[model samples]
Target: MTQAKADIGVYGLGTMGSALALNLAEQGFRVAVTNRETAWIGDFVKEAGPLATALIPAETLESFVSAIKTPRTILFMIPSGAPMDAMIEAVLPLLAEGDTIIDGGNADFNDTRRRFKELSGTGAHFVGMGVSGGAKGARHGPSMMVGGTQHSWDQLRPMAEAIAAKFEDDPCVAHLGPDGAGHFVKTVHNGIEYADMQMIAEVYGLLRDGAGWDAPRIGALFEGWQEGPLSSYLIEVSAAALLTVDPETGQPMVDVIVDQAGQKGTGRWTVIEALKMGESANTIEAAVGARGWSSEKSKREIAEPLLTAGTLEAAIPSETDLEAALIAARIIAHAQGFRLLGAASEEFDWSLDMVRISEIWRAGCIIRSALLDDLATAFRDEVPHGHVILSPNIAETLAQKLPSLRRVVVAGASLGTALPALSAALAWYDSTRRGRGTTNLIQAQRDFFGAHGFARTDQDGKFNAVWPDLASEGT
Candidate 1:
């Protein structure tokens, strides 16, 4: 138990871990770095370059723990779940009072809370830090969302922000809240990522199926959209992927790609949490379902003969029409995802600052883009809990573009191309315009049958239409 006060001690020298360590070292932080295998340490040191001398290879957990100063901060970059649990168990005995452990892996939020409680007895702090952006972003600066004690967060903020991505002079990292909030936000971020990617796929499918356009032409259309409201990193990459030709066949490489999609468990977890919280996350849920369904592509193909098919030969809409539709659908999908995040925040009592969350996602996170700035601005101008789609600016944006989006959805449905996010967004708009239909009907029925009071449509009165005679005294 030696007094220690270093900037970072990063364990597990994988790509993400190494990149983060490099970022910290570049920021002039004294980072003690180690991995389980000694050989990997040399490779990490080499990859880290000038930062190599600062890297300390710890052969044992005791040494790793002892290397950091008091109020010690050690970050775990290991595989999540059981492996992480085992590591925590191994290191807990070696850590001194007031030492902090940051779990930077994608561990479940519940596990974070449990670990936080378990470590508190030793006066040790546990911080669940949600680190996003891929390998490259990690080295440059990734978005970070952290949850733990306010005191612990305050201690970590400077270093975290120093190594974070920035947007319009604001760092793309924040103290989300206490306990599990960081991982929770990160979970929702993944859910939105799923929806965003699916929406892009739908746009690509509509263009390819309806226009008979080659991949390069479709890629060009995406490139044009990238300069407009529909612009995003996902769209940018998709356009590039479409333009790449297979060296062997000289055909568009996208054509040879499998129609199926894959997903990790985060999207599913988001959908489940949304269900538990009674939130409308149709777009996000649909995206998850779409991926699951796509995984059964072979079965779908087998069943195709039994299903009626429609031709996708409708005339291609104008670029303006396509752009407007895509933009509107994307906005709606994003709204649904944000709405879910809001609901989860409230449900979990996270007290999360929506504006900050939006700002973070506007830059280095996977969902980062210029569009999120508009979303953040919109959130800042209104009641924090206001319905996202009902925000004045968002409403106007959706109103002007809904028709074209509807047309796209119809075309996608007819062509049998999966467009779950598009469909969910369309349905959300419809429900918003008409009012949510199912719950109202159920409430009305409940009032009619059981005298459970319901609001009257004609007036402000609370009334009940009773079926008392049917439950007769004679019976």
Candidate 2:
């Protein structure tokens, strides 16, 4: 028996887990992995190839935990929720004091909190880590979000910093806060991603229906967008997805694909959190709604019979105007996401660092973009202002881009193309700027129906009004 010490033990050897293990091995860390089956274990070991020496395979749980030294670090990359809890239960007996268990899953933040509490005082540290950038990202570089104690982070930082994607030598990884905070931010990241993708699809719909452009035509435009302010991983992939030609039919690949969008629930979770926190994540909420509506084909078919397949109404908004509008819309959507995070931070006393979040997101994430560089800079000397929009540089940019956004929204409404995300973005912007909104009538209606009472603008106290007699009612 070649008795050797392993720096870390990875308990799952699925695609992402295997890739992460390989990445760890590549960084010169001795990675021990375990799974129920031996097939993936063999495949992983063989694939490790020249780097095989750094890979350790433990078929049993006891052997896996035994391979690591004391105060051991074991990372669980299993499915979130029940499976995660089960794994923890199975591993608890083998663990020692100061040992750490990191959950690298897309877990609900509430679930993460539960796990953190369950693992507390057991002499084992629990960390909820959010790993992004998919399979390739896991193998090469990923944006890592960690929530745990300072000591737990210290133990993991060296490996994390080494493996993460770097922007100007800055690693795309952060110890966001303590317990559930990392997963919460990651959940919101996915939400912003949903909004980004949905908005892109909405824009493409406008291009297709309003401009009478085919997939390749639109794809080429998206390709062009990759070079400009809208440059990002999502935009780049969108171009690829649109441009790909199906080998079987010799047609645009995107043309044959189904329109029903698939979701994994993070987007909905974000909207739920927003509602709970009373933060207006309207742009993201609209995107999630648009996806749900897309799945109701029967309702759409029924509605389609009654609607006109309208032609181009107004001239398609200029490319320049559309791009400018997209920039502003992107800003608003991301700001809403951060707004939610800020609220969560305050509510939980997480002391979340907004700048670090943006810095890490600059690379190895679906939402990675050049814009994050600007956002990071804007947050570098943040003056405790609640919104990123309040940053002088960002405010100046929004001021410049507002006109383009207005023009695009007006054109979309006039031409009758569905721009739900864009329209919501504009509505949110407008509502934020309005010091006096038309909510007085709403208050009055509430008071009349439920006696909920209302606050007067001229007075500081809450007031209730007695029902007034009308011509239709007896005095």
Candidate 3:
């Protein structure tokens, strides 16, 4: 048994936990790990291979706590809700004053805030870390968002960054802000992720329904787009999936796949929080709804009769047109998603650095892409809190693509394929360009109901239109 120095302890040995542990060990950090089942620790040690030399598995939280040095740092990689709560309760008593606990899971921001307060009294620091990039990223670095006091953040930043994904040579991790800001940003990230995935799914639907394309053909088209403006990790993976053929049946595999989708609750939680914040996240909500609806495929199929059940008959658009539309729509979707993220950062008073956030997403994060590098560049050159869509570079990109985006939205709607995100993206572009054209209807509605003052079209001053008296009275 190695005496615990200033080593980090990782509690939970699931896919994420194990990968993170391995990375930490590889970086020469003495790592103490514990799981409910002792056998899992053994499995982690074996999986870690050569890095296992630095790993020390503890049988219990008390043992783990006892082994670690003062100001010990422990990362919780368990599921959210009860399990997380239980782990905190079990470990808090064992931890000394000034020790730190990091929740490196998809925990609720509010919960993190509460935990911070709860643990602060005991002199233990609490950090809410939003980890992105799935299993692969976890094992080989991922983008990390951390929120805590400056002191605690300073202590942990090196380790966090060391294990994070990077853009170019820079780590894509940042000290998000105080309290629950990290988790909040992460929550919004998941929301955007949900919207992004749905957008891709909608594009696939358009290819299948409107273009009457087979999976292999659609996959090939996506592969081609990967070299153009629409290039992205998601698009690349989707193309690969499309190209996959079933060995036994020798057909396009996607055609026979089930429509059911799975969600990890973060997206739904983001929608709920957005409502609480009085923020517009229509695209994200629609995406979540789409996933939920997909889960009821049997019911949907039975209730909504298909008029034409044979192979798709609609004509596919020319490759040039399709590529142009896809790129345009993707840009718009990214804009809308990032706009929502910006709004959330403001609402939560997170003071998040959009540039660093974008940089992180450019690599190790699930939403990482070449496009995000452009966003990061735009952010670095602009003021913090500046609207991303209004950034000179982004605006130019949007202007260049707007026409094609409009065409794609029209085509998707006419074909009766669900493209909520794409539709919302088009709406965002239109709304921003019209310069208050979208606000007039709501302003008029307010005047009709409560007689709220309205801004004059000809001038900048606010004015209230008078209405004739309706109630009769002796004057």
Ranking by TM-score: 2, 1, 3
| Structural RMSD, model 2 | 1.7
Q: Which pairs clash in model 2?
A: none
Worst lDDT 10-window in candidate 3: 308-317
TM-score of each: 0.91, 0.97, 0.90
Which portions of model 3 miss their true places by more than 4 Å? 1-6, 306-316, 383-385, 446-475
Better of 2 and 3 by lDDT: 2
Residues 1-475 of candidate 2 have per-residue lDDT tens digits of: 7667898988889988988999999999999998767667887798789888998898889989999977788888898988998898999999998999999989999999888888889999999999999999999999999998887898899989998999989999999999999999999999999989988887888889777899998899989999988999999999999999999999999989877887889999999999999999998999999999989978888998798856446767888888888899999999999999999999989999989999999999889998998888888868347689888888888899989888888777777778899999999999988999889999999998788999998899999999664555854
**After aligning candidate 3 to the native by TM-score, how far in Å is the CA of 326 from where it should be?**
3.4
Model 2: per-residue Cα lDDT at residue 91:
93
Kindly provide the TM-score of model 1 when superposed on the true structure, using C-alpha atoms.
0.91
- Candidate 2, TM-score vs. the true structure? 0.97
| Tens digits of lDDT, candidate 1, 305-423 | 98877665555567777778778877877787777777877877888887888899887888887779888888898743467778888888889998888787777777676678888
Best by TM-score: 2
Which pairs of residues collide in model 3? 142-165
